[model samples]
Target chain A: MAVLDRDTINAVREGFTRHRLSWIDTLPFLFAALMYFFAARYLPLGTQVMIQVAFALSLDLALGYGGIDSLGHVAFFGMGAYAAGLYALYVSSEPLSGLAVAACIGALTGLVTGPLVLRARGLTVVMLTLAIATMLHELANTSAMKPITGGADGLFGFKIAPVFGMFSFDLYGRTAYWYSLGVVAFVFIICKLVVNSPFGLAVRGMRDNPVRMRMLGVNVTARLVTLYCVSGALAAMAGGLSAQVTKLVGLDSLAFLVSGNALVMLILGGAGRLYGAIVGATVFVALSDRAAAIDPFNWLFAVGGVLILAVRFAPQGIVGLIADWSQRLGWVRR
Target chain B: MAAPALAIEGISKNFGGLRVSRDISLSLPVGARHALIGPNGAGKTTLVNLISGLLQPSSGRIALDGVDITNLAPERRVGLGLARTFQISSLFPSLTVAENVGLAFEARFGLDRRLWGRVRSRPEIVEGTAALLQSLGLLELARKRVADLPYGQRRLVEIALVLALEPKTLLLDEPAAGLAVSDRGALLDLLLRLPEALTILVIEHDMSLVFRLAQRITVLVEGQVMTEGSVADIRADPRVRDVYLGTRSHG
Candidate 1:
């Protein structure tokens, strides 16, 4: 205690605050910016990649950072899609307003499902998430809900107001591309804030050892639920963006494959890194588009091959490689 | 008894037909230094688990500062100024030692749910975490990941984490379970120097450490209290020797 005066303690405390946002964190955004400006012809594909990045980023928060293993995250995504779609049909056609509604619905979906899904761990968590997603998918397809959900045919017919009521969603998808990119950027920043925050540290701590966290008076389950809710909201935002951009909410939005694909993207890019989502989504969407165009019937073969290669070579994700490189470069502080 | 800081009344726990704690009762008054010693399979850890709300007793009530908390969640009990260290060191391995201690410190300030900003931006929590680590001689290890630390330092970090809670009642389950002699000496000194008003219940197999730390010692046999008395009384009790003390190698 004698050695720990005000200055000494402050110095030690200063250690925790050592790593702030660095130039390296902005590299991914810079890449995206370059793509936006230089590769404007591929805006439609770029928009799809951004939406997937947003979705995968949300999954990374829940499964990677929060230690919540959800195999059915598409439930929130589909809910967001429907929230935007239904809002457009019955409420207002404004895209921003619809996206906000979608985000709230995603958060609401999380609040409802987090308690049920987060209470379990490992296989049970997976089953519960998958079950919820399946149930949502079935409900959307049910004829009883056909008038509202569009049943199996998909939800459309509602026109989305232009960006700021100026930039229309053109045939080239220029506006939708930029809009989704903005949403993805927003999601990335949120993840960054959370990762550096006390709440994020607590969530990571709980994920590492929940029993120890409980002993420290941390309501582990409650914190987890909150994280799940946030992740859900973000995932829903991605869904809403998809609906607005594509102008269609399909049964596939809630499909199990979507959740599986999101997980794949996260795993391939690295689960916990914010940039991992960006890298994963961009790579996944690009690969899918090329494979589908080259050989439409067996595009899964290309995805499956890439996934296997990613799993075998870089199990920690592509972002993990960058981290190692940064460390080896002798410039990264931590 | 000056309003005991912790009271366990007729606490009993069973696993199907097997009973781990049987009608056990103990009271630790405020500022009391109490130790519970028992032979292996005597359910010493079970009693600690029951008190800490990790395991529920089939029939018993656990109270902290005179409030019954028989059904409180483990985290709820911790919120009411109860903290504990496990016999085996448990920590967030990937995080730095500062982060581990900082998480506990922030939780005390009800900042665990604040999601918007960086945790280190807060001056109070950072200094509090630093002061706690510095006091424990763990300042140099602040940035090191817990997974890379040696076993001895891990135990010290566990203590740091527990103390960050500023608990009124502390439960140390073999605080020096696997430490070397030098580490054990350090731990003994640390335990002896804890706040005078903090009630402590330490479960240990090391008799010398127990003797130096406990004002009163309770010996348990088969999940039931065999004897409860001052340190001298337990040291001289032949039955305690026959059941527990005699069975283990003396320090």
Candidate 2:
């Protein structure tokens, strides 16, 4: 038998606490990348799912960690899509700069609306976020901006330059797939770093008990707003990636359906855990795509059935369930 | 004595038409141990809330260390060396015990806003958290989630959280409310052993613990102060006895 006293047990556990992501954590990313070599025919579909993962991760940061409960996060996503699409069309076709421009616009949008929407909680927050996204959607739909936004016809006259002025975006979408994967990896790394930092801990604290956090000398609202903007920028970059890869930005980018779908993905995969975003997006996108091909009219029924099963069996999300099993098997200690 | 560590002058609060706290005034001198006792709905918690800036007072001012903080936010007041624990054991339930206390240390050092480095890897936070948990005899449970701990242990964590801030003044709301009879002694011992330089305003119903740890006692009734004096005076006061017997079914 092991003579493990409580103090000795705790000390040992603390010594090896996984505060930062390890090389093993990158295995999933490597696996996702490796899949491209085998599934060349499905590269575009995989790229779209990866973009969804990036977007879902952004939402997870705010809705999962920050307890933001925003239903209109796609506003930033849509804004980024349009910004990148328009920039490539009118200003510069540099893919990197397009992402940066989209991120800035998204961050700016978050900065402007965060204070107002975050001031309220629960249903009010959801409603205000929806209103903001709806307003932006309506603005994009207006005929006055038709000359610029394409006015529901969708923005399509854009030619994105080759990646880093080298590898051209090919017909097979191999470059675009790798490009989206790279951005998603970069964003995922940043998110991991953020959630492990002191700021991340404080955000989690706010989610658990804002009153306690306030009494602990935290400027709760300021932190919330800052997080909102950062998440916004990241989500926008994902949108920019989507625009760059698709060569199209449409009204659907800013649609409530997009926001609702991302939220659904977050819940299906789980929220607080970042990997949940990855798993949720991949599973949802892949299943939905396959289901649509199998029976376009009845695809919703398949997706709904899967969601019901996931909610019933793994309400905490796929990551949470995995975490539980790992802990039980002594493979992980959370 | 040193301009009072905390001073509440003519503070009153009203929710709608019902007055919860009315002209309740109290002074806590530097390094003093004061106890506020009252029956249910007597506004002891309300008064504590007003002092801690959780609830806005309709009238009056609260000064901390010669600084008027009546209009300051709760976080700002905490910056001014005011700390408090909730009656309901407010904690980051999903986080581990060490993380909970570490957050307080992070807050005290103004590192709560640091967005770059890993919190657990910081030597200061890790060492500070260990030292704090060791002192509270909770080093063993550091890895356990706050939500998974027993109710009494959660309360101790609450106290540890506040102590990690190292505030000059602490407002404890029902710190000993639901402890087993056996645990109250340890709770009292912990309270008594706190540094003499820290002024504490404890709202407790445990007369034994209060009478032992508190040097001064202030009794309240129906949102108003009934009396204030030394423990002996408070214990001997017939009015205090009458109020206790009428309000308290069990200690």
Q: Quick one: best DockQ, which candidate?
A: 1
Q: Evaluate all candidate structures by whole-model CA lDDT and list the values in order.
A: 0.89, 0.89
Angstrom error at residue B204, model 1: 0.6
> Second chain of candidate 1: TM-score?
0.98
What tens digits encode model 2's per-residue C-alpha lDDT throughout A1-334?
2233556444723732344678867876887778888878899999999899999999999999999999999999999999999999999999999999999999999999999998788899999999999999999989898888898899997999999999889999999988998899988988988898889988899999999999999999989998999899999999999999999999999999889989989878999988899999999999999999999899989879988888999999888788888999999645
Runs in model 2 with CA error above 4 Å? A1-19
Q: Evaluate model 1: give its lDDT.
A: 0.89
Tens digits of per-residue lDDT for model 2, B63-129: 9998999999999999999999988899999888888888898998988888898886776677777
**What's model 1's lDDT at B166?**
93
- Each candidate structure's TM-score, on Cα atoms with residue i matched to residue i, is 0.97, 0.96
Clashes of 2: 0
Evaluated on chain B only, candidate 2 has a TM-score of 0.97
